[model samples]
Target: MSQLDTPRLPENASDLRSLYRAAEARAARLRVLVEAGQVLAGATPETLDAAVCEVARAAAHLAGYESGRVVEDRPGEAGDDNGLIFPLTSPGSDVTSPGALVLEGRRSAPSAEDREAVAVVCQLIGASLSARAREARLARLLGELLRGQEIERSRIAHELHDGVAQNAAALMRRLELASDGDPADLAKARDQARALVRELRRVIAGMRPPVLDDLGLVPALQHLAAEARASGMAIALEIAPDPGHRPPPAIETALFRIAQEALNNARAHAGPDVHVTLRLAYGAGRWRLSVRDDGCGFDPDAGRAAHDAGGLGLAYMRERIELLDGCLTITSAPGAGCSLLAEVPAA
Candidate 1:
């Protein structure tokens, strides 16, 4: 509640009535603010819209109105008087925003103090609405990420069934055939065993790179660069002066995945004879990983929109950083090289 000066003593009958009414309005406004605070405090993001209406009704009561109704001012359905409508701002809306609270006014109009009380409650409601919007967006992102994980799991299962399972069975058959003591069969069986090991390693690395677990991010990135170079892309790796502290395992994994996706995007879409650079930097208690490519680039907004609709590419990269409360930036334009930077504050 705001601090306000006390009312002066009335010197006449009309002045007394007016002063009493003013004092009563002030007291009612204080009560409304308290009730509105409690209502807003008790509200959850899921129930916030209803809670805003409750605050609006409380404001109406304070203004000496019999009843109030919260209404969204959609086109062609608003039948209420404009003067009685107190527009509630949405998370990022200006004046003329549609959501509002309407007092069922029949008697005298509300005073300035009463309107101010309404305004304060409306501001609180707006804040709560913003919170609700953020929570809802986060929930959606979590759901999409989970779905992406399930899809990845299915693909891995498919790979194992097709690659690993059949190769293992064939390797066993080769070993059984080699039991006959033929030197050629023995040599073939040994080669099959080595091929099986390599396949297993590839699959395991796809699931999670062993180097990432055994060494650290730098070594894992080196392995990644080696693999990328094997596919004809010139790669350069850079690391900042060591801050002598490694990011947590989760953060490290996120950084690696973001880099991986960025590299994959470049490999798929970037023009031929492209050179890609992966940079890792640590400074001021923050870790930054960036991937830049000297390949032909496209509009990031269009690419993001296309990938978002398909639930892949930059969308999932953004999801990984968002989960860690980090920032992901995509900088590119048509005919310009692309750069992606994912940065997280280190604790």
Candidate 2:
């Protein structure tokens, strides 16, 4: 073989041995990371926690520690004094995560490579934990949606029993008493029939707005703005240029409902004379809807907590968007205005 193609060797036996040992150590570190990655990547919901623990165990063994324990990040709580704590970092965020991996004992300080391996393992764990938390939150929101549906049904039942049903019964009694052809009784029954029609129309609109099906989303929103304007509210509606293709029924319904609810909330909680703006924008393969009210705002954290305790607030909105692989965000403070934004992919 040519000299350039020949393999080179260390001049001394000790140097050769050292080189061999260094290569072996590098390979061992890489092998541990690979194995840990496999465990994490293939972990199912049932095996997630166990897989995380296994990764910790393997990392501890590689770090020259007897064992390791997970220490949750809590105020005024300290981890083991005798161990080295490696903070778990989230893949999405720069902050130190909720928990850390603490290697139990250090007869000698772990090498740089060992520390790096542990750090990487912690990142993997952080990402997995975040995903698990999101899954749990989504499940809770779904349960809330079901409960909200029941509550809505109860409200509709009450309206029917007290308003429509009661009015109908009174109209029937008036007609029966008017069998004598009395003009006053007949006129009263006619007025009652008209009133009943209006109430029925209101109920039907609440269930599903006719304008939405007949005129489409843009016109429906324009109708909404006109209604608000007639009620003496300063509101502006803006629609971005459309691609001329209507969104799927579910998307249209969701966006309209969200906008309606947001406007209602603004009217109820926002102080008098608060200006509101509603906008819809379209982008490549996605659409965005935003409602902003320059009114008295409230703590979003408190609102979210209230929903978690079953208040059916922004959490329900988020659940609706998330179901369509979308995102919903609410920004507000005690003095600042409230802005509710939702983005969904085109179907």
Candidate 3:
């Protein structure tokens, strides 16, 4: 009786000790998080990733892992090899699978004592690492988005300053010549002025597509389809009922921007012979914008990683959608085509 009871008492004591240690470790980690948060408050893109990596490595050490690194999860790097690959898995143990650890780590076996402790540590480490990864990703996306917006503004400024402004000056010159020439020349100059005015209006329309705000989502998509068809790309547009009746301004703006970005991407990078599809649908009080292009397709995940690092177009579209509480998903495989889907709450 003495031997059996003695064994029970030590086991209980060991359990209590484990609980105390775990609690203390958790408190210590919370303090570390507070410090990290303070640093993150003033962090910039150049230093954000490095900061996150340092925290992740520290967390790994605390969890008894040998090493930890921050990685971006993208095509060709999904699953175990994806973002922030940690050596939490075994030769084939699911206990260390990144996804599993993310969801919640479980014991490898009933009697696996050390594995249980490791699993808990993995959970804390994984949570912290994942949070840092997301923050870094968001920071990168914002930088790229701002860059794209600046480029667009510059392009528009140049077009107005060069194209429309030059043409208007030429029309003015012709008017002055007409004033000093024959009546016939004056009549010809008047005609020229009218034509120039029409051309200016067209340029303005290109600068700000009117259908986007005046006629709503379907009409804007239809106009885009018409423009694509004029460019030698076969275009198709489909709309579900109730999408255009009443939509949030933010959602409308996001969809318009995304559609414009998608078209520009297809034209600039995917070549002219691409087939394009623009669709808007309302379901369960949500609005979805989808753009599909049948051109040379690159890996969406890989492209997104590149985009997150610095590419402008897709990153801007994603940021715009995200700002409006929407979600952006891109799907593509090499030579298989690309589809971008954005969904926002209509309500």
Candidate 4:
């Protein structure tokens, strides 16, 4: 055998025992790291606390501590002991309030290897928690973005519906009353004015339906269904008797916008005679809105790839749902219809 492949015998029994213990400790450290990685991989804002506790338990087991716990080191908390206390700090952050990992009931000071292993676990947990915090911050920002956009849309829609559309209708009436003009010219002018008014109304609806703000979501959806039917699309709406007693304004707005986008996509992509169904149901303190269309659907994988290349519609739907701590799911396949579903808490 090659010299590098040959195993060397230890000089003494003590040396052999030392080598064995070293190998065991190394293996334990590797196992702890693997566990830590798994925990971090599954960590999210909702399950962060449980994941941290699992990491701490594993750290304690590997470091030979009787028990371990993770404590949030808020101001005015008790001081930490001299034992293994790994401070969980995010990189390049001046804010040190993240907290610490505490290992208790240690018979003696931890060895260097043990300290290193525990530190690795602490680092993983800290980074994962930090990422979750950043995610929450980003979600809040997106929520604010959606709220601002909706408010602006509502303002513009109100202006167009009340101000511009009324003026156009009045102008059309004036054109009809004119007595000195050629009949054909007057008629053409009146037709053009009427078309303008209709187009403005459509624009107003697209900006933000006033019914959505005046009445609740159900009435707004009913109005939407009527408009769709007027446009020769077979659209049906099924709303719950009580949609969780009407969610918060933001939730309502997001759901409405999501449905609006889904419908627009169906109209654009779904072939003629596409039958679309919009359903809203409330149960268990949550509301679900689904839009399904029996139209020629594209491959979902191809759609996702296109989205990744810069499709904002689907991305916006997901962002809105995520901001509300909810879920958005789209299922579609070639020759199959597409279904868009969004569920959010009532509150």
Candidate 5:
């Protein structure tokens, strides 16, 4: 038969609808196979081709091939393998006949239509696979970066709490021991010592708020408000009683960082006299943090576009919230204001 006469493959609307059914069935089977292969891949953590094989078998089934198998081109199979094979069943028969329906283009002849279809399918599948791979890689990289940042912060916090703080206390004791001096000088020395202690505390708080570890999220948030007030920032923080509930550490951290970043953005870019508000509410077995600022707001979409060129603060905040299976919404308009809402399930 000619190339256009290659059995037509049922072109009627009813037949095409059935193709959807077939496609759904094929997708279900492929999902099962791929999921199973993923379990195996997780267990062994070394065999990628096997997982690809499992997925290919499903593709073959959907394409009406009788049987399919993945084969390697290498003699000893030391590297990646060749194309897939899907044997065809003879016409007017459900049973797969031997040595039929060959789709091996790299090693054998494949029809032009089949080749085009396969190329499109592979292109789509490849795009999906590449996206997934990139997500995994980015996750790993971000995890490493966060871990390193945490370590560095912890080190800096320790130095401030131990070395710098201790030296400030010693200076205070020495000031007390000094012979009589000008009252103004003594007053200035006392104020300078107190300022030094306050600066150290602020640094430690930034590294990791002590209340977060000791008191819980509420007190931690209160500390944030207190520090903001200390810095002359107009911050209004309101927290409903926890209702005797807590969130996972990761969720709490995510929310805290969201708040911190939002506040920082407001302070840095929103200009002075900016109004900041934070609210925490509980419902539907979840807790949400909402931050609003009446600053010189810009478009959220524009901010995202700007972020694509290496400005990662907002993106990082969104990533953290999403990693905890949460949703982040950013609403803003030029000269209107900015509002960020993040929700995470409570523990």
Candidate 6:
């Protein structure tokens, strides 16, 4: 065979051993990357330190170093100079002082290949840490936004209940006392004032339901279903067996709001004689709330696009769920019905 066409093989035992070692190193590096991915996937503020430490240890193992550590480079603090240091830098940001990954007690100076592998691992770690930080910051902002919305709703509800509602009641009483006026005119005025009072009370309840705070989620949902029934919409509320357990106030508020929005959407879109179903279930370290209707449905993609373009009801529901680290899903088809399902961690 021509030399150019011949396949090459290791010529000696030493060469074979060298090839085997190189293969092993590559395998080790792959394993390290896989482990790092798992750590990053499950990362949270509570487990971040342990995750970083695990990544450092894996990098050190892959690079044939005795030990490695991740160090935050604080102001006025000295960093280790004896070992290889890889700075963790984020893109487009000068605000964060980069941390360092230090590898110590290497048997010999790292080869060019080894240094390259370590660099890749360091970059992975840095990106993961930066992503975790950004997620935490976004979560905080969402929490504040939800809290502000709740506060504003409470304020408006209080004003309507105490101001507008009270005035309407007083006007109704005045109409009742005017016996000298034309009987038909007085009756019509009194009815109009009473209707205004009922409408105002409904608005206040919708803005911020008192049952939600007083009796918790199940009772609040039941009350909502009763209201829907009164409005000529049939709403069925099904709660799991363990309805007594309550989540944190923020979580409860978020779930309630999401469910409320979903029901409102159904009431507005679903035609008469439609049966709406609301289900709440808790299990397996998570809780889920679902609202489903049998009325004509729209295209889910179109609905989602509309929501993205500032359809406040669905958008608000999604934001509230996401703020609590929950998931919201909408399902629909042209002739079928629409369903909204929200899930959050029970803990």
Query: lDDT at 198 for candidate 6?
Result: 76
Model 3 TM-score?
Answer: 0.62
> After best superposition, candidate 2 residue 259: deviation in angstroms?
0.7
lDDT of 4: 0.78
The C-alpha TM-scores of every prediction are 0.72, 0.68, 0.62, 0.54, 0.54, 0.52
Per-residue lDDT over 135-175 for candidate 2, one digit per residue giving the tens place of the 0 to 100 score: 77768877878877886698789999999999999999999
TM-score: model 6 vs. ground truth? 0.52
Model 6 residue pairs with clashes: none
Residue ranges of candidate 6 with Cα displaced over 4 Å = 1-200, 307-311
Q: Per-residue lDDT for 144-198 in model 5, tens only?
A: 4676477567767788877677768777765875547767667767776877778
Residues 1-347, model 6: lDDT tens digits: 89999988999999999999999878877788878878867888788779889889878767767788888873221334445677765565423534878877775566677777777777777777787776766675566567557756776778787777777776766676776687776877767677677767777687778888987888888888898899898888899766568877887888887777677667667666788999998888888999999988778767654432322356557667776788899888876988889999876
Tens digit of lDDT per residue, candidate 1, span 1-347? Answer: 33466656778999989888888778878888888888988998777778877887787777667677666653222324423666665545322334666677645567787778877777666666666666666786777778768867886899899998998899899889889898998999888888889988998897789999888888888899998998888999998765566689989999998887777778878889989999999987789999999888888877666534422467667767866888899999878989989999886
The lDDT leader among the candidates is 2
Q: What are the per-residue Cα lDDT tens digits for candidate 4 across 1-347?
A: 89999989799999999999999889989988998899779776788888888889889878777777887873232323534677875675422437788887775566888888888887787788777776776776676567557756776778777777776776766676665687876876677677677777767776788888888787777888888888899998998655535578898788888887787778778789999999999888888999999999877777764432322367667877977989999998877989989999877
- Model 3 regions more than 4 Å off: 1-135, 242-244, 302-311
| lDDT accuracy of residue 182 in candidate 3 | 76
Ordered list by TM-score, greatest first: 1, 2, 3, 5, 4, 6
